[model samples]
Structure formats: structure tokens, C-alpha cells
Target: MHSFFRDSPEFEQRKRRPYSPPKVTLAQVRSAIPKHLFEKNTAKGCFYVARDIVCAVVVYKLGWAIDPFASTFGIVSVAVKWFLWVVYWYAQGIILTGWWCMAHEAGHGTLSNQNWINHVVGFLMHTFLLTPFYAWRVSHHAHHKATMSVERDENYVPRTRKDCGLPDELAAKLSDYHEIFEDAPIYTLLRIAVMQVFGWPMYLFTNAMGSPRHPPYTNHFLPWSSIFKPQHCNYILISDAAIGAMGYVLYLWTCQVGFAYFVKLYLIPFLCVNHWIVMLTYLHHCDPTVPYFRRKQWSFLRGASSTVDRPFLGWAGRFFLHNVSHDHLSHHLFSSIPFYNQPLVTEHIKKVLKENYNYDSTNSFRALYRTFTECCFIEDDGDIVFYKNKNGKTARVLADDALDAPSLH
Candidate 1:
């Protein structure tokens, strides 16, 4: 029976499969990389922050110059003016997002080896964008510490059918076939739009997609929330004060300029920052093939490997977002690695992990649609589980037994 099984076509197919985990330890993976890659150059990191800040300022000024006549073009139609404003918003937003990524690096202590510099730069960049720097830094640390753990991950926790509390009829409509064929494209687009526009704010205010923890509500801005400890209350208050000061500044600016002009210059671009952030994070962790692990099977390596890297808006996207989307796995593995060094580290990771590496080079919009449509709710209880469509069909499941199989090497 063993001989016959070995000779079967199924055995041949299994032998030809490409995906498998690395046989090496995390320390081994680290040892294989060049030691110099870990060295943080404060000057170089500050240069990047300065460059992004200057570019963002230039873009902001350009938009300000164009604002008054933005709607006054006689040769251009209203639609054209609207399109130009959109382009302006997107341009400024992408640059702002780059600043946000720099702050993110600061949070990871990659902006510079100096803790004070990282904190100072991170606080300023994040406050300008209205994000609570310390609050986000602490929570994001939790996210990295518990990436794919269903019980502890800090962001983008998928809901199950039971958790969603969807009525039977509504749940039935979310079935695989209905979502693809029966549901209107407009409905899906609208849902995506809502998520892009309001998801970040909602998460900050209500911790809408955060881990299911005690007290039922976990806000990022609140120190008393379960997301932070009592010791963090002081930093949270500082963050709130920073945000309040920025708001007051904006209010003073708006009082000088018209509210409409302020909205055009600042509010629209700010929304774009939120949109990019939400879309980037949502797509990073929400792939169908990625498994959410329960405590029984959870490990740091496993959790980190569960994230997939995606390309957004092509080269421009990578540039503006500081390769955050493209090299996310590397960032997850070594949070303190600088953005400039991420690509080099990521290549090394891919070489070591080989088939275990997960990268989806799909167009951003298509990937977004695929995740929203297929990667919905997951099973609450599982050693490993893929998300399921509304109809209760498993969207995608990893080959756990095979991944757990003995290393080919």
C-alpha cells in the first residue's frame, strides 16, 4: 500500500507543490543578513524626513496658490476643475502619507537610534496629520507583537457570522455566488468607499476593527481604553493636547481664510491621507489565503508570515508611501529596520523563505475588491482558519498539513 501510494499521481503532484515554510530559525534568518543593515544612521533618516516634509510643504503651497482659481477656469468645465482638485488632493495626500510613513518609522524606532529624536519627529508628523503618535505607537507595537492572532491583533480583526450579528437573510446575501454575480457592483463600491473615507477615524474614535477585548469598546485616543494601560494615560493626554493645539491652529487659519478654502486645502488632503492609510492596512492583513491563528498554533514567525505584501499605485505609490506596502513582511519581521533598508532585508527574507514567502502583485483596486468580497468573517474557533463569505463557504484555506510537513531541505 505504501509503494502504491508513493507511485500515485497525487503523490507526484504533492512533490511538485511550491509553498513551504522555512526550515531555519528566526535567529538563523537574522544571522544570514549583513550586520550593517541594522545600523541606524540618524543623519540619513533625518534627511528623508526633511525631504518628505519639504516636498509636502511645496505641494501644499502649490495647492494654496491654485485654490482661488481652481473653480474659476473659463476654458475648463466644472468637471475638469473638479478633476484638477482631485489631482491636487491626491498629490498632497500621497506626500502627506509619506510623512505619515516616516512617523511610523519613528514609532518603530527606525527614524533614528536616538529615542528622543524618534519621539519628537514622530509626535510632530503624526500631530500635523491629527494622529495620536504615542497612542498609535503603543498600539502598533501590540499589532506587530500579535500580527495574526485572532484574539490579540490590534487592527483589522475580521468578524465571524456570529460576531457580525447579521440576520439570516442579510448573511445569506453575502454568499460567494451572490457577492460575485447577484450583488450589485455599486453596493460593493459604496462599501469600499465608506471604509476608505471613514474607517481610520472610526477606528481612532471607536476602535471599530480592533481586537475583541474586555469592555466592548477600545478607542485609540483614550488612555483609559483597554488598548492602553494606566501608565499610558499621560502620553495619551499629551497626544490629545497636541491634536487640540493643531485644531486650534487650523481654526485660526480657517478664520483668516474662508472655511471653503480651508476645506479645499487641508481637509480634502487630510482625507486622502486617511484613505491611503486605511486601504494600505486593510489590504495588507486581509488576504483570503492568510490564516488567523488561535493560541494553539500561534507563533511570532507564523503570525508575521501571514501578512502579504501588495503594490499600490505602482512606482509612485512605493515612493510616496516609503515602500511600506511593498516591504510590509520585512517590516513585520524586524520593526526597527529603516524603510530604506527594508527592500534589501525583504530580498534576503524571500531567499531564505522561498515558497513560504507571500506576495500578491495584483492591481490595488482589484485586490481591494477581492478581499472585501471574499475575505469577510472567519471562524471564531480554529487552530487555523480562512475567512468565509456570507454563505458560510470557506474563501481560502492554507495547506496547513503540508506547511507543517517535514522540511524538504
Candidate 2:
């Protein structure tokens, strides 16, 4: 159909037929692009290697800062070093985010000419993040293959307002919070922070805040039988061990160096990285107008077309999301392409899709605000739902048994 975010005259015509995007054939996609753009070898390798070296240096520097007892001026040197450590922590997030993107490229089998290299890099990157490398690889691969199909889309699937089951009162209440918190910067920040530190762990143990589309698979990372799969649990434990060991060592040094400098320089920046990861993932797929398709009507192309690109953030998106956000449609179209090449391939596809190509270059702040207020706690038609107004009084909408079709318009 037409771009759901905006209402244009062209959108009106598409609305008449409820447009279904054309099937994106491999030949068509390939024919529209230049052959040279698909090459996998180059500067991306150097970048990845540089990141590994930098992460190594940060760890080394932190290790060197462990002076259990030192003079006043010596302590000051330690403080400055710690401040640099914090800066390095922030840099780590950006670096790790890039590494995560690379792993995603591996998921797409795009990191190198060889598929095995992609798997190796993807597994290591995800494992370090305490994610189940193979499992997430499988699920994310499916997500690209079925980007917005309701029955198969992996994450952030939207429901029509009518499908929403909340009674007027409950629906009002849900919408009220949705109004206040859905896109609030503070709220988003808190959610991201909480999720980063605890989200994966919680999702692992409890399956909270995961994609409904995944169903029984939503809890994929959990060890139903054993908790120590190599990439799933063992690697995370190792990571935790490293962090914990460093934290303990830092604590010992703080006895002489002072607590004020320690917290300010190291802990805060460590916290910020979690914030970035959670926020980036949350913002990517949670669009108000993006739809999920059922298997009967779903195709690879329509699912891919469901994604929208953001501007200003697109560069970071490419770096952090493995270029999944920039030319996201191509990602859905061909998950095997490498991250460095996605933009080139995306530009090519845009020409073919023409007006059908969807990109939202709106200010993310405004878009985020709008998304928060208008979009939250959506339900399918025929369910008991609740919402409350500013006064906390309930507003009734539909009964539990009432059957109604979802409204896309």
C-alpha cells in the first residue's frame, strides 16, 4: 500500500485497493544495482580490526589504573585515568554497537565473502553481548525474511485500533500512559537502561517484553534443559566474570583513590552503553503505521517494504544496526548482503520501487513523541481492554465478545 505514515493523494488511490507491494524478485533487485557495489572485501575489515584493538586498549588501561594505595597527586593521576576510562566506556558502546552491527552483517552473511566468517564474527559479537548467537541469528534471519508479516514478523508488529480489545475505560487508561510515556525521552531512556542491564537476563529467565510474533520461540535463549550453552550462557557468564573482576579491582583501588572519582569516571559511562543499545533497538521497529501480515497474504517483498528509514540517525543506524535501518528494505529483501554494501543496494532498489519506497526523514524527537502518545497497548478486535482518562475514570469502548475488523485507515 501507500506509505502509511503520511497521507498523500497517491496514498488515497492505493487506499482504494489497499495496495500490496509487488514481489521483489532477486533478478529485479540485482538488475537495478551495480555489480561493483556487492563486493565484500575492503575498509570494513580494517575498521573491525581497529575496534578490536581499541577495546583491548581500554581493558589494558583500566587494568593499569589499579593502584591500591598511592599519594595524593598519584590519586589525582588515577582519577584522570579513570575519566579517560569513562570516555573509553562511551567509546566502547559505540564500538560495541558497531561490532554488534557487524555481527548482524554476519547474520546476513555479509561480513566476508565466506559464510563461515560471518557466522564466526556474528557468534562472537552476540555472545559477548550475552545473546544466544545461533538462536538470535536464526530468529533475526527470520525477521528479515518476514519483516512485517503479522504471522511471521519477528518484532514490533503493530495491530489495528479496532483489533484492539480494550473497553473504552481501559483503552482510555492504556492510551493515557501511552500518551505520557510511549515516546517520552526520559521514559524511553529509563526503559532502555533497565532493559540493557536486565532485559536480556529477564527475557532469558522470564520472557518479558519480547516479540509476540515469536510465540514459543520468544523464549529461545533460555536453556529449557541446561543454562550453559556455549554462546548462550557460558559466554555471558565469562563476560560477567570479566566485568565483575574489574569492578572488584576498581573497588580496591577506590579505598586509596576515593569513591567520588571512581563512580563519576567509570560507572556512569558503563551505564550509558546499555542505554544506547536498548534505545536503538526499541526505536527501529516500533512504528505506528507499520503493519504485520498474516502468512496467507505475506510475501518477502511486502515484509521488507514495511520498514522505514530515519535520517540524521541513518549513519549511526548503519553503524549500530548493521545498515539494517538505512536501506532496510534491501535487508528484508536480501539478508545475505554485507552491511557496508547495503546502502548502495538500497539506493538501487529505491529506483525500482519509486514512490513505493518508504523513508521517514522526520525529526526523530518529534516522531518519537508522536509514536509514544498515539501508539501503545494496541489490541485485536474482540478482547476485553481498559483505558482511563486524565481523571483516572474509565472509558468504555467495546465488549469482550464484540467482533470487529481492524482499521488501517
Candidate 3:
């Protein structure tokens, strides 16, 4: 995608064509990348994990060290304290996010070739963030396999025009949108704010914004929540236990250090991590130009390549965030390729993919705002679908004939 959003009326006339099956196979995609890039370096993975841990500890120490200096200082003491605390929070939060990226790699089996080691590292790192690793791993793996499939992708599935209580027909003119639909900027702001803070937990607890095919109240915690199979039940229980144990540890830490300190040390950073997580995931897949596929129209190649790759936070993002956003397209195609190796893999795959690969360096905040408002509901029909705005205007259009893009489901 050259840009994340489009305002042209020609988009409606020039309906974007659905992807045909890739000219190359998965084996071909694998072959195009250098062999060494695929090597799962256990030592390198551990080193990254250790480095993140050390950074986190340093940030924690720096935060704790701030108070004594603040107290000893003269007139600007309170102001300095507040500013320092903000800096600490920012540093601490980003470092914690680095851990999240490593855990994500572990979940994807990119951390190590040894599956058990991946499990242990992933479980520990995610539990530190209060996430249920195996449970989320199950769905995340599913998402990789079916990235942009409307019925199968694990999260941020779009509602249909009908589902949004809008008419089936595309709006006659984009200009007439105000009278046609409820356009409440304040409500959108309120929704975005809530999602920024609580979206991750809400999704885990209630499967919020998950695929609509799953039953209501489907969750990541329960094995029988429709997201998991009977085989996954034991893993689900283990994840639940890990989360409970982490919660208790936090409680104990609070008791020892005082709740205020606990809040400063952990809770603030945790919230920042959540915000970044939500941003990364949402911006990757939820956009007007991105396509969602039905069974017949979908292939592993199309599903994997359909999403956007963004440069979030620039060099700081690559450093603290493990290049997860920077090389997401290649990551989806080959989840086992670690972030460090993804550049080579990405370049090779981009050659194979040609125009299929998407990289947008649109400022994340701008991209988020555009995506949140402009990418709303898709048409209820079509095997290949693109999002329509709240105004019932589509950024790109596909043929209206049901026969052209017949539902395989």
C-alpha cells in the first residue's frame, strides 16, 4: 500500500481486484529466502531476551533512584520529579514492550528451533506481561495461517455493512454521507480511548473484536471457549494458572513496596505495553485497502501478504520493539524467521511477491486515526472484501455481482 488511506471517488469505480492464487508456492517462497536466515538461533534468541531483561532492570533502578535526588533538590524539586517519573515510565514501558516482542517471537517459534525452549521462554515472558501464552499462542498461530480471512482470522474482524445497520447499497455520493449515517467524532474518540486502555484484556476475556463466527463470550482463558479445541484444554489450564500466579506475585510486590510504588513500577508500563500492542496489531491488518478473503478466494500466500508492514517508532521501534512491525509481511509468511533475519527474508520475499508486499511508513498516529474512522464495515457479500467507512463509502470497490466473487463458505 503506497498510502494507508485513499479519498478518491475513482476507487469506487476502479474496484480493486481480488488476489488470484500466487504464481509461486509456499515452498517457492521459502526457497527464495537465504537458508541462513531461516536458522532458529537459540543462543541469539536468549541473548535478546537477556538484553531486554537487563534494560528493564536498569530502567527500574533508574526510576527508584529518582526519588532521593528529587527530595534533595531545591525549588524545582516537584517539577523535576514529575518529569523524571514520566521519562522513567516511557523508558520502562518501551523496554517492557521489547520483552513482548521477544515473547511473540517465541510464540511463533522464531526464538528457537527447540520447541520446549520456545515454550518456556514464551510462557515466562508473556506471564510477566499478564498474558496467557499458550492460549494466545493457539489463536495467534491460527491467525498466521489465515491472516486476512474474514471467517478464520483470530482478531479485529470487520463487521459487514448489514451488521453495521447500514444499507446494502453503496452510498450514492461520498459527499452525502453526513445525512446517511451517524457520524459522531466524540463517540469514536470515546471508543478509541477505551480500546487503547482495555482492548487487549477485553479481547482475552470476551473475544472482543474476534471473528464473528465464534460464539458470544468466547474467550482465551477457557479451553472450551470456541477458540480452543479439546486437545488444547490442558494448555489452557496451564496458561490460566500462570496468569493467576503472576497476579499473586504482583499483589505480594504491592504489599512489600506499597501500592503506589507498584503502580508506578508495573501498572503504568503495563498500560503502555497494551496501547502499543493494540496499535501494532490494529494498524497491521485493519485498513481500507486491506482485503479479507473467503474460503475459495483465500490461499496461504494471499492471506499472509495481504496485510501492511509499518515502521513504528523508527529506530527506537526496531531497537526496543524487535522490528516486529517493520517486517510483519515476511513474518506472517514465515513465522519461524526471527526479527533480526527478517530483513533478508523480507527483501527476498518482496522480490517473489512483487506488488503483493505492502510497506507503509505513515506516521502510526495518523495511520491509526485514518484506519479507525475510514475502515469500518465491508459489504456483506463478496469472497474478497475491502472495508467501507462509517459513511458507507468504500476506499476501494470490488464487483457487486455475487457471481464474480462467489462465497466459498
Candidate of highest TM-score: 3
| C-alpha lDDT of residue 274 in model 2 | 50
Sequence-dependent TM-score of model 3: 0.90
- Write the residue-wise lDDT of candidate 2 on 1-409 in tens digits: 2243544443233323333344355567667878777677735754764665476466546534543322235638778665555555666556566665666667666667776776667766655555556656555655666666555555555543443444454446645545443455687766544666665445544445444534443455443313234545554444445445655777787886688656644455445545555545544655544444555545566556656665525565555445655666676666656566777788888877765566656555455544444445444432222222223322233322222333121
User: So what's the TM-score on candidate 1?
Assistant: 0.88
**What TM-score does each of the candidates earn?**
0.88, 0.64, 0.90
Span of ten consecutive residues with least summed lDDT in model 1: 2-11
- List, residue by residue over 1-409, the lDDT tens digit for candidate 1: 2231122332233224533445666776687678888889999999989889898888777776674565677667566667777888989989998889889999999978899999999999999999999999888999999998888888988886566654443445544435433457798799889999999998888887888774565677778888888999999999999999999999999999989888998999999899999999998898766678777667787778768777676797677788898999888988878889988999999887766577876667767877787776876566777777646666444554634644221
Task: Please rank every candidate by TM-score, starting with the best.
Answer: 3, 1, 2
Candidate rank order under lDDT: 3, 1, 2
Model 1 lDDT, residue 213, Cα:
74
How many clashing pairs does model 2 include?
A: 28
Output the better candidate (2/3) by TM-score: 3
Best by lDDT: 3
Kindly indicate the candidate among 1 and 3 with the higher TM-score: 3
Residue 100 in candidate 2 has what lDDT? 59
Provide the overall lDDT of each model, using Cα atoms, as 2-decimal numbers.
Answer: 0.79, 0.54, 0.81
lDDT of 1 at 187: 82
